[model samples]
Target: MSTVDLGDVDRFTVAALGPVGQRTFLLQCRSEQTVLTLKVEKQQVAVLAEYLGRLLRDLPRPGHLPEDLEVEEPVEPHWVVGTMGVSYDAELDRIVLIAEELVPEDEEGDAARFTVTREQAAAFAVRATRLVEAGRPPCPLCGGPIDPSGHACPRTNGHRPPTN
Candidate 1:
Protein backbone atom coordinates (compact mmCIF):
# COMPACT_ATOMS: atom_id res chain seq x y z
CA MET A 1 0.00 0.00 0.00
CA SER A 2 2.30 2.66 1.27
CA THR A 3 5.88 2.54 0.09
CA VAL A 4 6.62 1.55 3.65
CA ASP A 5 3.75 -0.10 5.43
CA LEU A 6 4.05 1.04 9.04
CA GLY A 7 2.99 -2.16 10.76
CA ASP A 8 6.34 -3.75 11.50
CA VAL A 9 8.35 -0.53 11.64
CA ASP A 10 9.39 1.06 14.92
CA ARG A 11 8.43 4.45 16.40
CA PHE A 12 6.88 6.01 13.31
CA THR A 13 10.22 5.94 11.54
CA VAL A 14 9.97 5.13 7.81
CA ALA A 15 13.21 4.34 6.02
CA ALA A 16 13.63 6.08 2.69
CA LEU A 17 16.24 4.64 0.32
CA GLY A 18 17.46 6.50 -2.73
CA PRO A 19 17.79 6.18 -6.46
CA VAL A 20 19.05 9.78 -6.34
CA GLY A 21 16.74 11.74 -8.71
CA GLN A 22 13.55 9.89 -7.88
CA ARG A 23 11.10 10.19 -5.01
CA THR A 24 10.72 6.77 -3.44
CA PHE A 25 10.67 5.07 -0.06
CA LEU A 26 11.88 1.65 0.95
CA LEU A 27 9.33 0.20 3.32
CA GLN A 28 10.93 -1.95 5.93
CA CYS A 29 9.36 -4.61 8.08
CA ARG A 30 11.11 -5.78 11.22
CA SER A 31 10.20 -7.97 14.10
CA GLU A 32 12.25 -8.72 17.22
CA GLN A 33 13.72 -11.28 14.81
CA THR A 34 13.87 -10.26 11.13
CA VAL A 35 13.81 -7.38 8.67
CA LEU A 36 12.19 -7.06 5.22
CA THR A 37 12.36 -4.30 2.61
CA LEU A 38 10.15 -3.02 -0.18
CA LYS A 39 10.10 0.14 -2.32
CA VAL A 40 6.93 1.95 -3.37
CA GLU A 41 5.53 5.29 -4.48
CA LYS A 42 4.58 7.80 -1.76
CA GLN A 43 1.06 8.63 -3.00
CA GLN A 44 -0.29 5.17 -2.21
CA VAL A 45 -0.63 5.86 1.54
CA ALA A 46 -4.26 6.99 1.59
CA VAL A 47 -5.38 4.13 -0.60
CA LEU A 48 -3.48 1.74 1.66
CA ALA A 49 -5.24 3.10 4.77
CA GLU A 50 -8.67 2.74 3.21
CA TYR A 51 -7.99 -0.84 2.28
CA LEU A 52 -6.56 -1.59 5.69
CA GLY A 53 -9.71 -0.33 7.40
CA ARG A 54 -11.88 -2.29 5.01
CA LEU A 55 -9.77 -5.34 5.67
CA LEU A 56 -9.86 -4.98 9.45
CA ARG A 57 -13.53 -4.18 9.99
CA ASP A 58 -14.42 -7.85 10.19
CA LEU A 59 -13.20 -8.02 13.80
CA PRO A 60 -15.99 -7.88 16.42
CA ARG A 61 -14.93 -4.55 17.92
CA PRO A 62 -11.97 -2.27 18.42
CA GLY A 63 -9.70 -4.49 16.31
CA HIS A 64 -8.29 -1.37 14.79
CA LEU A 65 -5.42 0.33 16.62
CA PRO A 66 -5.98 4.06 16.62
CA GLU A 67 -2.47 4.94 17.66
CA ASP A 68 -0.77 2.99 14.88
CA LEU A 69 -2.38 2.57 11.51
CA GLU A 70 0.23 0.02 10.51
CA VAL A 71 -0.87 -2.78 12.79
CA GLU A 72 -4.13 -4.65 12.27
CA GLU A 73 -6.37 -7.49 13.51
CA PRO A 74 -8.97 -9.45 11.58
CA VAL A 75 -11.94 -11.51 12.82
CA GLU A 76 -11.21 -14.28 10.33
CA PRO A 77 -8.50 -15.81 8.14
CA HIS A 78 -7.95 -14.13 4.78
CA TRP A 79 -5.61 -14.00 1.84
CA VAL A 80 -3.62 -10.84 1.29
CA VAL A 81 -3.10 -9.81 -2.40
CA GLY A 82 -5.40 -12.75 -3.00
CA THR A 83 -2.43 -14.98 -2.33
CA MET A 84 -0.19 -14.26 0.70
CA GLY A 85 -2.11 -15.40 3.75
CA VAL A 86 -2.62 -13.38 6.94
CA SER A 87 -5.41 -12.73 9.37
CA TYR A 88 -6.37 -10.70 12.43
CA ASP A 89 -4.50 -10.86 15.71
CA ALA A 90 -7.43 -10.31 18.07
CA GLU A 91 -5.32 -10.45 21.21
CA LEU A 92 -2.95 -7.87 19.73
CA ASP A 93 -5.93 -6.18 18.04
CA ARG A 94 -3.89 -5.54 14.93
CA ILE A 95 -4.21 -6.72 11.36
CA VAL A 96 -0.97 -8.48 10.48
CA LEU A 97 0.23 -9.34 7.02
CA ILE A 98 2.17 -12.61 6.99
CA ALA A 99 4.82 -12.18 4.34
CA GLU A 100 8.56 -12.48 4.22
CA GLU A 101 10.23 -9.11 3.82
CA LEU A 102 11.06 -8.61 0.13
CA VAL A 103 14.60 -7.64 0.81
CA PRO A 104 17.35 -7.76 -1.82
CA GLU A 105 21.04 -8.29 -1.15
CA ASP A 106 23.76 -6.15 -2.66
CA GLU A 107 25.97 -7.81 -5.20
CA GLU A 108 29.68 -7.03 -5.56
CA GLY A 109 30.56 -3.86 -7.51
CA ASP A 110 27.13 -2.26 -7.21
CA ALA A 111 26.74 0.70 -4.86
CA ALA A 112 25.61 4.29 -4.70
CA ARG A 113 28.40 5.28 -7.10
CA PHE A 114 31.86 4.31 -8.32
CA THR A 115 34.58 5.22 -10.82
CA VAL A 116 35.96 2.78 -13.42
CA THR A 117 39.57 3.18 -14.43
CA ARG A 118 40.60 3.06 -18.13
CA GLU A 119 42.86 0.03 -17.63
CA GLN A 120 40.07 -1.95 -16.00
CA ALA A 121 37.60 -0.91 -18.68
CA ALA A 122 40.01 -1.88 -21.48
CA ALA A 123 40.61 -5.27 -19.89
CA PHE A 124 36.87 -5.80 -19.73
CA ALA A 125 36.55 -4.94 -23.42
CA VAL A 126 39.22 -7.43 -24.44
CA ARG A 127 37.58 -10.18 -22.45
CA ALA A 128 34.20 -9.33 -23.84
CA THR A 129 35.52 -9.37 -27.42
CA ARG A 130 37.09 -12.78 -26.96
CA LEU A 131 33.87 -14.14 -25.48
CA VAL A 132 31.91 -12.82 -28.41
CA GLU A 133 34.34 -14.22 -31.01
CA ALA A 134 34.29 -17.75 -29.57
CA GLY A 135 31.18 -18.71 -31.64
CA ARG A 136 28.31 -16.46 -30.65
CA PRO A 137 25.89 -15.63 -33.43
CA PRO A 138 25.91 -12.28 -35.18
CA CYS A 139 24.63 -9.54 -32.94
CA PRO A 140 20.86 -9.43 -33.13
CA LEU A 141 21.32 -5.75 -33.77
CA CYS A 142 22.53 -6.61 -37.31
CA GLY A 143 20.83 -9.95 -38.02
CA GLY A 144 19.80 -13.19 -36.31
CA PRO A 145 16.89 -15.36 -35.15
CA ILE A 146 13.77 -13.43 -34.16
CA ASP A 147 13.52 -14.69 -30.56
CA PRO A 148 17.24 -14.16 -30.03
CA SER A 149 16.89 -10.60 -31.29
CA GLY A 150 16.90 -8.16 -28.41
CA HIS A 151 14.13 -5.90 -29.61
CA ALA A 152 10.50 -6.42 -30.52
CA CYS A 153 11.36 -5.19 -34.01
CA PRO A 154 9.58 -6.09 -37.21
CA ARG A 155 9.88 -4.94 -40.79
CA THR A 156 7.07 -2.68 -41.90
CA ASN A 157 5.61 -3.06 -45.44
CA GLY A 158 8.64 -5.13 -46.55
CA HIS A 159 10.84 -2.14 -45.74
CA ARG A 160 13.49 -3.24 -43.28
CA PRO A 161 16.13 -1.09 -41.64
CA PRO A 162 19.46 -1.18 -43.51
CA THR A 163 21.19 -4.47 -42.72
CA ASN A 164 24.84 -4.90 -41.80
Candidate 2:
Protein backbone atom coordinates (compact mmCIF):
# COMPACT_ATOMS: atom_id res chain seq x y z
CA MET A 1 0.00 0.00 0.00
CA SER A 2 0.98 3.65 -0.45
CA THR A 3 2.02 5.84 2.48
CA VAL A 4 0.80 9.33 3.28
CA ASP A 5 1.60 11.75 6.06
CA LEU A 6 -1.30 13.34 7.95
CA GLY A 7 0.37 15.43 10.60
CA ASP A 8 0.66 13.11 13.66
CA VAL A 9 -0.14 9.77 12.04
CA ASP A 10 1.56 8.41 8.92
CA ARG A 11 -1.41 6.79 7.23
CA PHE A 12 -1.07 3.45 5.52
CA THR A 13 -3.10 0.32 4.97
CA VAL A 14 -0.91 -2.24 6.71
CA ALA A 15 -2.58 -5.48 5.56
CA ALA A 16 -5.75 -6.76 3.95
CA LEU A 17 -7.67 -9.84 5.03
CA GLY A 18 -8.29 -12.04 2.02
CA PRO A 19 -10.68 -14.97 1.86
CA VAL A 20 -11.01 -17.69 4.50
CA GLY A 21 -9.35 -16.47 7.74
CA GLN A 22 -5.58 -16.44 7.77
CA ARG A 23 -5.19 -14.62 11.09
CA THR A 24 -1.43 -14.34 10.50
CA PHE A 25 -1.25 -10.57 10.39
CA LEU A 26 -0.10 -9.56 13.89
CA LEU A 27 0.98 -5.95 14.10
CA GLN A 28 0.15 -3.04 16.42
CA CYS A 29 1.95 0.23 15.87
CA ARG A 30 1.39 2.82 18.59
CA SER A 31 2.49 6.42 18.85
CA GLU A 32 1.84 9.02 21.52
CA GLN A 33 -1.39 9.98 19.80
CA THR A 34 -2.89 6.83 18.23
CA VAL A 35 -2.59 3.13 17.48
CA LEU A 36 -2.62 1.56 13.99
CA THR A 37 -3.73 -2.07 13.71
CA LEU A 38 -2.41 -4.36 10.97
CA LYS A 39 -3.41 -7.94 10.36
CA VAL A 40 -3.70 -10.73 7.78
CA GLU A 41 -6.39 -13.24 6.99
CA LYS A 42 -6.53 -16.94 8.02
CA GLN A 43 -3.41 -17.73 6.02
CA GLN A 44 -1.10 -15.11 7.48
CA VAL A 45 -2.39 -15.91 10.94
CA ALA A 46 -1.47 -19.55 10.43
CA VAL A 47 2.01 -18.47 9.38
CA LEU A 48 2.57 -16.55 12.61
CA ALA A 49 0.89 -19.22 14.70
CA GLU A 50 3.98 -20.16 16.71
CA TYR A 51 4.77 -16.75 18.29
CA LEU A 52 1.23 -15.50 18.83
CA GLY A 53 0.24 -14.22 22.27
CA ARG A 54 -2.36 -11.88 23.75
CA LEU A 55 -2.99 -8.62 21.87
CA LEU A 56 -0.58 -5.86 22.78
CA ARG A 57 -2.43 -2.79 21.54
CA ASP A 58 -5.87 -1.55 20.45
CA LEU A 59 -6.00 1.00 17.64
CA PRO A 60 -8.27 3.92 18.53
CA ARG A 61 -9.19 6.86 16.36
CA PRO A 62 -8.96 9.93 18.56
CA GLY A 63 -11.78 11.78 16.84
CA HIS A 64 -14.25 8.90 16.93
CA LEU A 65 -15.90 7.11 19.89
CA PRO A 66 -17.27 8.12 23.31
CA GLU A 67 -16.52 11.36 25.17
CA ASP A 68 -14.14 9.79 27.71
CA LEU A 69 -11.55 8.68 25.15
CA GLU A 70 -11.71 12.11 23.53
CA VAL A 71 -10.81 13.77 26.86
CA GLU A 72 -7.67 11.60 26.82
CA GLU A 73 -5.66 11.76 29.97
CA PRO A 74 -4.35 8.35 30.83
CA VAL A 75 -7.10 5.87 30.14
CA GLU A 76 -7.44 3.22 32.81
CA PRO A 77 -6.13 -0.23 31.92
CA HIS A 78 -8.82 -1.54 29.55
CA TRP A 79 -9.61 -4.68 27.59
CA VAL A 80 -10.17 -2.98 24.22
CA VAL A 81 -11.36 -5.34 21.49
CA GLY A 82 -11.23 -4.53 17.78
CA THR A 83 -12.46 -5.51 14.29
CA MET A 84 -9.63 -7.97 13.86
CA GLY A 85 -11.45 -11.17 14.83
CA VAL A 86 -14.93 -9.68 14.58
CA SER A 87 -16.94 -9.41 11.39
CA TYR A 88 -19.87 -7.21 10.44
CA ASP A 89 -22.47 -6.75 7.69
CA ALA A 90 -20.62 -3.96 5.88
CA GLU A 91 -23.79 -1.82 5.71
CA LEU A 92 -23.90 -1.03 9.42
CA ASP A 93 -20.21 -0.14 9.32
CA ARG A 94 -19.30 2.72 11.60
CA ILE A 95 -16.84 5.40 10.54
CA VAL A 96 -14.22 3.96 12.89
CA LEU A 97 -14.48 0.58 11.17
CA ILE A 98 -15.04 1.72 7.60
CA ALA A 99 -11.50 0.95 6.58
CA GLU A 100 -11.71 -2.63 7.76
CA GLU A 101 -14.92 -3.31 5.87
CA LEU A 102 -14.22 -1.60 2.59
CA VAL A 103 -16.85 -1.95 -0.14
CA PRO A 104 -16.56 -1.53 -3.89
CA GLU A 105 -18.88 1.47 -4.39
CA ASP A 106 -20.55 1.66 -1.00
CA GLU A 107 -23.74 -0.14 -0.10
CA GLU A 108 -26.82 -0.07 2.15
CA GLY A 109 -28.02 -2.02 5.21
CA ASP A 110 -26.73 -2.65 8.73
CA ALA A 111 -24.30 -5.32 9.91
CA ALA A 112 -23.38 -7.35 12.97
CA ARG A 113 -20.91 -5.74 15.29
CA PHE A 114 -19.32 -6.11 18.72
CA THR A 115 -19.05 -3.44 21.34
CA VAL A 116 -17.16 -3.20 24.65
CA THR A 117 -17.45 -1.06 27.73
CA ARG A 118 -14.78 1.47 28.74
CA GLU A 119 -13.79 -0.59 31.76
CA GLN A 120 -13.42 -3.72 29.68
CA ALA A 121 -11.39 -1.88 27.06
CA ALA A 122 -9.15 -0.42 29.72
CA ALA A 123 -8.59 -3.82 31.27
CA PHE A 124 -7.62 -5.26 27.90
CA ALA A 125 -5.14 -2.47 27.25
CA VAL A 126 -3.56 -2.99 30.65
CA ARG A 127 -3.21 -6.71 30.01
CA ALA A 128 -1.55 -6.01 26.67
CA THR A 129 0.83 -3.58 28.32
CA ARG A 130 1.64 -6.18 30.94
CA LEU A 131 2.40 -8.76 28.25
CA VAL A 132 4.77 -6.42 26.47
CA GLU A 133 6.36 -5.40 29.76
CA ALA A 134 6.71 -9.07 30.70
CA GLY A 135 9.52 -9.56 28.17
CA ARG A 136 11.55 -6.87 29.93
CA PRO A 137 11.72 -7.85 33.64
CA PRO A 138 9.94 -9.29 36.62
CA CYS A 139 7.35 -7.18 38.44
CA PRO A 140 7.66 -6.99 42.23
CA LEU A 141 3.92 -6.91 42.79
CA CYS A 142 2.94 -10.08 40.95
CA GLY A 143 6.33 -11.65 40.30
CA GLY A 144 5.75 -10.40 36.67
CA PRO A 145 3.39 -12.83 35.03
CA ILE A 146 -0.02 -12.65 33.38
CA ASP A 147 -0.87 -16.33 33.59
CA PRO A 148 -3.07 -17.34 36.53
CA SER A 149 -0.27 -19.58 37.81
CA GLY A 150 1.74 -16.46 38.53
CA HIS A 151 -0.94 -14.80 40.59
CA ALA A 152 1.74 -13.80 43.09
CA CYS A 153 0.78 -10.26 43.93
CA PRO A 154 -0.88 -9.96 47.30
CA ARG A 155 -1.86 -6.38 46.63
CA THR A 156 -3.66 -7.27 43.42
CA ASN A 157 -5.82 -10.28 44.28
CA GLY A 158 -4.80 -11.09 47.86
CA HIS A 159 -2.98 -14.21 46.71
CA ARG A 160 0.09 -13.81 48.90
CA PRO A 161 0.74 -13.24 52.60
CA PRO A 162 0.74 -9.94 54.48
CA THR A 163 4.16 -8.57 55.26
CA ASN A 164 5.28 -7.30 58.63
Candidate 1 achieves a global lDDT of 0.32
In terms of lDDT, the poorest run of 10 residues in model 2 is 4-13
Regions of model 2 farther than 4 Å from truth: 1-113, 136-164
Error (Å) of candidate 2 at residue 29 is: 20
Per-residue CA lDDT of candidate 2, range 98-118, in tens?
A: 113322445332222233332
The TM-score that candidate 1 achieves is 0.30
Model 1 per-residue lDDT at 111: 12
For model 2 the local lDDT of residue 119 reads: 33
Instruction: Residues 1-164, candidate 1: write the lDDT tens digits.
Output: 22223344331112223332243343333444334443433333223334444553554434222233132222111211211223555565544543332234442211111121222222322332332233223435544323222333354333443332
Please, what is the whole-model Cα lDDT of each candidate in the order they appear? 0.32, 0.31
- TM-score against truth, every candidate: 0.30, 0.20
